[model samples]
Target: MDERSQFLADAAAQRKERELNRVQTETTLKLQALARGYLARKKFVSAVRSTTSEKFSAFVDLEKSEKVLLSNDEVLKWSRLFLRILRLPDDNEVLALLVPDTSYFHWTPSRVISDIISTIPQSLMYISGNRVTENSLFLASNEHKPLISGQALNALFSILFKSVKNDENLLPIFISHVLTCPAIVVHLNKANLDNFLNSELFDRCLTYLRSSPELVESIEPQKTINLLGNVIHLGYLDEETVKNRIVDWTWVIGLVMAQCTEFAVRPGEQSSHNHWHPIFGHYRLPIDPKLWKKLGGGSSSEPTHTAELEKDIPPTLAAIVCQLYMTALSTMTNMKNEIIAGICREDRTLRQLWSYLVRWGNQGRYVSSSSTAPSPLNAALSLMSCPQSLHAAPLMLFADAAAIVISILDEEELYERAVPFALEELVHIARFCNYFCFRAVWTGYVDDRSSDHGLFASIHQLCMVLHVRDSRRSFVNDPKFWLAPDVKSSILMGEFEKKTPRGVLLMRRMSHLVSLKERMLLFRKFVSADKNSNESSATLITGLDEAGIDQDGVFKEFLELTIKKVFDPALNLFHSTAAGVLYPSATSSVHEDHLALFQFVGRILAKAVYEGIVVDVQLAPVLLAAVRFFIQILLDFVVCN
Candidate 1:
């Protein structure tokens, strides 16, 4: 209210306003200077681009077709522009593009390209492990050379091995990309890789991959596992280069390493390796008290992570090589479709793709097999890599391998065959279950388990995994059979069948998965008036109680059986019922095929239980095949006779 006080406050306000205005004018002046600098840089870039475009346009030598291919040259132009932005002086990326030509396999790079390359520090671009970039150029889009033509495409990828081996900076990038990039993967996998593999480029990768202080990581080590999966993606290599070098035994001994990738579960121990999933289930492995000390190991007091694992020598990678093939097989399948769909049929990489598949299946783990018999399933997978002429041999062999595993049970007896074979099946089944789990993933029952990063551990995924693992051949729910439950229950199936447990008391957990109506029908068998069907529940119970049983095997078998028999109540309603659809070239959705295939497999299992014969122990699809050229050849000979 006092005039003198108001006047003092107004003068202070005017001083503050003047200071703010003075600051704004200075900032505006600085911004104008910066803008001019940026515009000059932009103008210089435009002039350089115009000059490059004019240079390309002035080429009267281009054929009409060549002009069309190079006319847009968007990818190249942008690549060069980006190279300039990085403050590089010359057109090295373009030169890098020209080098992959088999025609120029002898030709040298442009002097400028060489200079640029030489100037680039290996420290910034090295591909090997234990490295990091000062600036992250690893997945930058500018360096991406999409495989588009014969020599261009070939050189693009062929040089990747070179970049990986010699360009220390590029190695980690390559591995990281292979483990992550969907597009580059689509392209590299597309090439028919036989010839390209072991080419000087690939040979280098093999040499390095095989080199010691190999790539294997400590089990779930503190370091991030983002790149560990790339191992399963590569297809060709000598043992020295691949299996012996990259696998870790602690992880290999079971499902831990198997879980390292995006796959469902470790294909049955791939044992020549290990199972990542907790296959032991409710059955704990009973450590033979004396044997532990005999092995010079744990008295149950030693830390589980003690260095003693070296004594076991770990599961060799060879046993699970087949499973690894399956892992790569899907990648190759994607490449074949996506890459070649845009390019030619006979390009170098596409041709090499053929070879990679053959090698992919057969390579990886003799080290794994020494400790256990080779998996027939693993052997069966080798056909994915074979040349067309040799396909039949592996088919026949895979069939034999599968049958051998199906017939045997005891690991001691299986040491030479059965256990390994079953483990191999487990691997494939694990992959299949993973496939199912992802498809059937209980989404928004939580926020899409698929995006959970840890969805692999979700109940829905684990359940589908266990379901697929325990069942021999499930196509969905159609008639998927549960033989006993595990081998223990499988053995008891005959005795169970003989007594028939009319009231559903014996295997209540499993039968409960079925409806009351279905259980009632099954129960009717026990109380049947026919003498053959009379209740022998007492005999079944007594047999089960006859102590001194193999405890681990019993529990494992029971758990597996419970998994197999427990189906979603709606499983039968989801899949098809038609017999023809079971083997359709391309059936409908996975949900549609689930039941019929499940049921058909269930029927085969029922027969196996009744007759005590191994149900078609082969991995090849030969049994249900409708046509046979070999049979025709045999018939022709018979007619001539």
Candidate 2:
């Protein structure tokens, strides 16, 4: 017996040593990861400050040293470390390193290049002036030019095409960057431009942008507009070659519409007096008489011939402007149908395009005061009537789009129109909360936490709108509506003296109910309910009282349904254990399991009681049943031992 005991003790000690080693190894890895992250961030910040060639060389040396210090496998473990490294000064050498190759263990080349492009500063891409002129619109000043030169850019593009030429995913980021940099476009030699245009790159990029309207917004608005002007100028200068080289004209048309919406100036409104003519005539090309006629200018107007116009603005450029204006008008007329079709066909693009149009229209003079002008709000709201279109849309997308429309209506002071839509959409989202939660957990499309939080926030905002508009009574009459009674009281009693939405209150109520249901289950299986029986019973009654369950049938029904779903199964698990069916051992394993259950139940009950969700007298039976189960488990353990 003594030798047997000694052997068991030796085995236990070996197992404990193994566990300790495992824990130590895990801790070491985590510490190393943290240290690597710190070093990466430090190196990147230092590199960004290195503006001169000598300093940039030093930065490159530091990166090489880091590579030597850490193995490729170690670096791969630090996923976010590479992202920080891309924020370094935008040098071609550094940019080239970011392009994915076989050396990179984890990330693909396309992902690295996309990150590099996205890290380009917004200030670098956008410029501002008191007035919008050709000089202000395009990056004419040396200060506005990115650190990347024309030759370096061409090399980078060549490398990108050669490395990942067929990567459609990387094309949007590439196209957006190219469209935003006027300096790059203007400085590129004809050979490079011809090469890019001739390749399938341009066609693929345009096709991607059209199918994914959201990616269009990713391009800097000002720079893209200027790019449109440049492209049009090029097309006018070499009509036949430009037409053959260009992949699609609709992409060009889309660019024009985006620019017109952003600038909020119609072609005629800005160019009626030929203020843009001087800029175009600078290229010394002959002006087309047909182009002047299209711009609402008479054939007898001054500068009748190309020679009479300013030499600085080319006639070819002027003709391009005229064509762009005509295209903008045609696009504006059809934008409503196009946006609707885009949303229906691709749900992900819904908010991206909608927000760009809505924000531009709101901030600028895009919406005319004339009754004849189309209302973007009316056009967007029409989507709400088509439930089929939104059925498969992500919860976050649907909620955000609805919020934008409501905000626009509120800004326009169209209160009467906002009421029905707000109420209906709020109810629609509430019904889908469970579906969203389920989808987020089981599928990868929706983020588990943010989507639910965002949906609830949207719900609260709409509820507040209805409450303040004195329309809560209508919502209360609807069986589908779900807001706490206390929230209604706060709204009616004017307890919410500020303009706060009752959504916060509603969310709190829901959170409390969920906690109560979870705690009830925990209590039945693990806790010694007799230890705090009186306290638990009192807390349940208080929660029910606060929820106004006595007076509110809907709230009462919700609570009962939740209890049935969560508490009953937990009680069944406890009953089996108490009946000695699941108590296969009276060893430390059984005791440890019971102890863990007790601790879990205790923590939840404490929180529920504190939150006032455990205060209903109707929960007395459930609480007593838990106490009895706890006693039964203790008795079985003692007998088995």
Top candidate when judged by TM-score against the true structure: 1
TM-score of model 2 relative to the true fold? 0.24
Tell me the tens digit of each residue's lDDT in model 1 across 523-554.
55544444356556564543443233444344
Per-residue CA lDDT of candidate 2, range 418-464, in tens?
A: 33244454343333342322222223323323333323344334333
- Native-referenced Cα lDDT, model 2: 0.40
lDDT scores of the candidates, listed in order:
0.35, 0.40
TM-scores, all candidates, are 0.27, 0.24
Candidate 1 — worst ten consecutive residues by lDDT sum?
297-306
Error of 2 at 434 (Å): 63
Cα distance off (Å), candidate 2, residue 562: 98
> What C-alpha lDDT, on a 0 to 100 scale, does residue 384 get in candidate 1?
23
Winning model by lDDT: 2
